[model samples]
Target: MQKSVFLGALTVAGLAAGASAAATLDDVKARGTLNCGVTTGLAGFAAPDANGEWEGFDVAVCRAVAAAVLGDPTAVEFVPTTGKTRFTALASGEIDMLARNTTWTFTRDVDLKFEFAGINYYDGQGFIVPRALGVSSAMELDGATVCIQTGTTTELNLADFFRKNNMNYEPVPIETNAEALQQYNAGACDAYTTDASGLAASRATFENPGDHVILPEIISKEPLGPLVRHGDNQWGEIVRWTLNALIAAEEYGVTSANIEELSNGTDSPEINRMLGTEGNLGEMFGLDADWAKRAIMAEGNYGGIFAKNIGENTPIGLARGLNAQWTEGGLLYAPPFR
Candidate 1:
């Protein structure tokens, strides 16, 4: 009986130690600012403006989380990271969360020991060649010199695409989007390959956007979103559900303009619960009742962010194909807040 009691006490202490070690909320709150890892410079995704302020679709995710956690959207220190350095920055605790447009893959999730909070953008890899190259399709480019970013799935995808098509190409390895674009424009590379959305974002920054054509072929799945380090379930939940809150807000007809009114109280129980008008869901996540309300107000709803930043109305001119809400026949859906 004495041995059994000792073992039970040890088990309880172990569990308590594990729980204490997982308290990301406490750590972030004490830090007073969220360290967000973002792309070095992707125009519609995450980039610093002339005044050094970060803005774009991906940056909005960071701001939303900041609003949720620190009650201030602008209370974020945006750390620019390259494809090669992003994982190391997150793993080493240089950044609290990564809101870059990174793909969620098995190797990245398991091998890299990162938790993919959710898929905010469903994309695919593609090639962009200058229209003058006379390449109507990706397969038409034989013996092409491709400018591709290193440490990205694009590198392997480019190799596989060429091998499967029985084509030969030279790789001009570049480190960042800016470098790849420079090499492609300077005639050092015949084509550029990356996520289709990235291709569009890059093209939008060109002096003559119409001079480039993104090939019709989309190669690999790129479910891109925010990510946090593994073994921190609490931090993972904050990032994951923050993204879901944005998506859910859009689906439930919640907008930044109406969010303040709705927060007071809503007849829709789901909306009320989500906005913290009807439940203590925020308490469960170690946040105040107005956490999600602040998040939504930070950058508007998911749809609003898309349209204002990278949608068809914007210079990026990306149509919401697969990224549309599930209610509208796309894949964007979030679990109920309750």
Candidate 2:
């Protein structure tokens, strides 16, 4: 009958959907590269150097995942996306995962049909203005023109902050961090508003970084992280635990220099299990025994990546405030690897 045929077709379509959702890992392996979505440019987070080589804290996550899956850190195609384009790119499967400085939010996670793997950076919204503007705080920018990225929580936060303060401002919508910097420097906007960490990153790129000062007001909580499409739990688990491995590595004092020795078997039972000495934890995720080891070895540990890329010694000069390890009085905590 026609009804029976329609039911069978629906069943086949459901199976196909399930199969596509499960195909990300296998596709990356077959293609030999992980397509990682990143910001167009955000210094110390994700950006290209003068030589056009991409390197930053966010880039390290992609490299670590690639190393874990393919045993090659360089096996990645970095897809640069703007605020408006990032979600579309991920939803359409243009990229395997997004490691950009994207905030995790309710609408994005539920309505937008995406899964935020984990928070890699804890941040808050803040304002940055040229010191010449004589604006010491966000409250002073009552009627200022603000350069903010569209398609971001920044826009909503900016609106809320101004309304709460009973102030008003004009929004100069920008699509990328580089554009926001350009517009702010050109005096197109009176202030550049974004996550406080981003304000530091943006200011570091200026010719005279000292000319701009980030206002001290930390307005909104921004827990930025990697995300994947909603329907794929397997893919989500792979990316999520890959990040957790990095964090856990730092917690256990497992550096890249000693990962090989630790893989041989550590005296600590937790380290042994994490390094795949006792169980087929990697195999459970359809990876090799040395997956986490390779990921940690690709970069160092979480702290190592942070220090090398965007620490206070670097041009970005970001201190480990809220981003420090949980034990160090910050919120960066990893769940038990065991």
Candidate 3:
């Protein structure tokens, strides 16, 4: 089943054709829901909880977009997509946006005709093996059977890393993270290769997580973020600035606890503009003034979202590291709201 009458033209024809076609933002509004593409199931990223509600850092992006556009966070339909299917889902209009942990690469950005709004997480490729393998370093896995996910940057990076290291290895290609975990745990592969953050998330779900160790080698950079289709500037801006608002909210000390109070008034001009107290920024985007406020109130801020999902205290146990705010010496800098 495909929802791609207009998007098919958008994909095959040029950007001008897409622009002349039905606007995705308008389509989403008329449909009464935002279709958001997410991973099949990556813990602390995009997964169903016990009650079947999707929740995670990536899921929050979708909810925020829905809240910003539709004025209701729960108005999003979470579409689970694999690495191979995510792009098609976005291009075919099966999904309005993709908030999975996808990397920003040249080919995907250019050749695939997609646009990454901005990087939400900075990551690196890594290897994980059983502790008993005694493989403390990635270089030790010369003859390892690596479980790599197909249709992801990991495949090429794994090959490149092995070729550059002059090491011989066998590939065990899998589809989703769950399949990778199954194969790696079943001894079908000697090690699993993916983003370091993924390794942590996967290991955290194992029955005995302490039995595995992630190698220290970070083979390649993985700047992961939400993406929208190319040529849909309106839809793109909605997702892009919504993300920036969450980041900016954190930097400006705007949390869910005090958003309502701060909405009444604020001393900082930037905060006032960001929270929609004194600007027509949302109107400039053809949305209500409370667009960003709804988005921020839906999820708190970027740091709060991380801490509640995959941060140091969560099962993923990830530190702020490079994902901390720019003021804190990290790369997470949002543009001025004004």
Candidate 4:
């Protein structure tokens, strides 16, 4: 009786979820576009290019998903959202998926009712200060004015870290990274705190990038990723597997240059399965067989996206330290496609 009751409850939950998200895939197909939520002008993450085209690491994910679903990389409506507005935009169905640098946490996952598909970037909050400030460590910033983004985990983390360290700070709250950057540049705050990657990305945009120094003390573990509202399993699965396809494409040596040839056939059965040469995995997901191929060919793989946007060659100059492939001593490992 207990087992049957549990199974019955699960069925009801599944049915509810199905009803909620059954229209997402169809709506996206009918509308002929994917609405993706992104940050409000964060360089190397989701900023517009010289031609006003959205281009960056996070933007690449949106493009890939659009290609996978609509068979066109350009079929995306990039919705710029501030930290305060991103969740509401996604939950209200104003956006299909959120690719902004949002941290996944317990309150967000359970209380707010969103599903984090996977970790796109593993980051930690840190502080940045002008070299002229003469502060070498975060411990010395007692009573300092700190610029922080509102409606983010960074704010909570900042409060906890200061209280735990027996330090105090005056928070200069802002809604977007651009505002925080302006305040930090104008000396409105003695220090600016955010994800270490964000600090670096922001600093790279300044006129004198070398003047700002990121402190070595990283205070919080921020697992940043794309998320969708709860009760949207089918829509969630499309976003999840689309990300997995990018990671898997990197793992299996599939590049945009040779993807066409590999799609025809490959000696490795796993590669063939992922590229849709020898399996109908797409059928299981209610998508065509060329979905993964379209996604990969739209941009390259996960590594390609990172390198092109924020890698060492870029102004952001982030190393593939924690984001490298699992075989290369990093944590980016995708599940088996089969």
Question: Which candidate gets the maximum TM-score versus the true structure?
Answer: 4
lDDT to native, each model: 0.92, 0.91, 0.92, 0.93
Model 3 lDDT per residue over 13-34, tens place: 7756666544988998999999
Stretches of candidate 2 off by over 4 Å are 1-16
Clashing pairs in 4: none
Lowest summed-lDDT stretch of 10 residues in model 3? 13-22
| Cα deviation of 162, candidate 1, in Å | 1.3
Candidate 1 lDDT (Cα, 0 to 1): 0.92
TM-scores for all candidates? 0.94, 0.95, 0.95, 0.96
**What are the clashing pairs of model 1?**
none
Task: List the pairs of residues colliding in candidate 2.
Answer: none
lDDT by residue (1-338, candidate 2, tens digit) is: 99999999999987887777878998999999999999998889888889888899999999999999999999999999999999999999999999999999999998998999999999899999999999898899999999999999999999999999999999999998888998999999999999988898888878999999999899999999999987677889889988998998998899999888888987888788778897888888799878888889988999999999889899889898988889889899888767
Mark the 10 consecutive residues where model 2 has the least summed lDDT: 13-22
Q: Lowest lDDT 10-mer window, candidate 4?
A: 16-25
Clashes of each: 0, 0, 0, 0
- Give the distance in Å from residue 141's predicted Cα in candidate 2 to where it truly belongs: 0.9
Q: C-alpha displacement of 312 in model 3, angstroms?
A: 0.9
Tens-place lDDT per residue, model 1, 66-162, is 9999999999999999999999999888899998889998899999889999998999999999999999999888999999999998899889989
**Is candidate 1 or 3 superior in TM-score?**
3
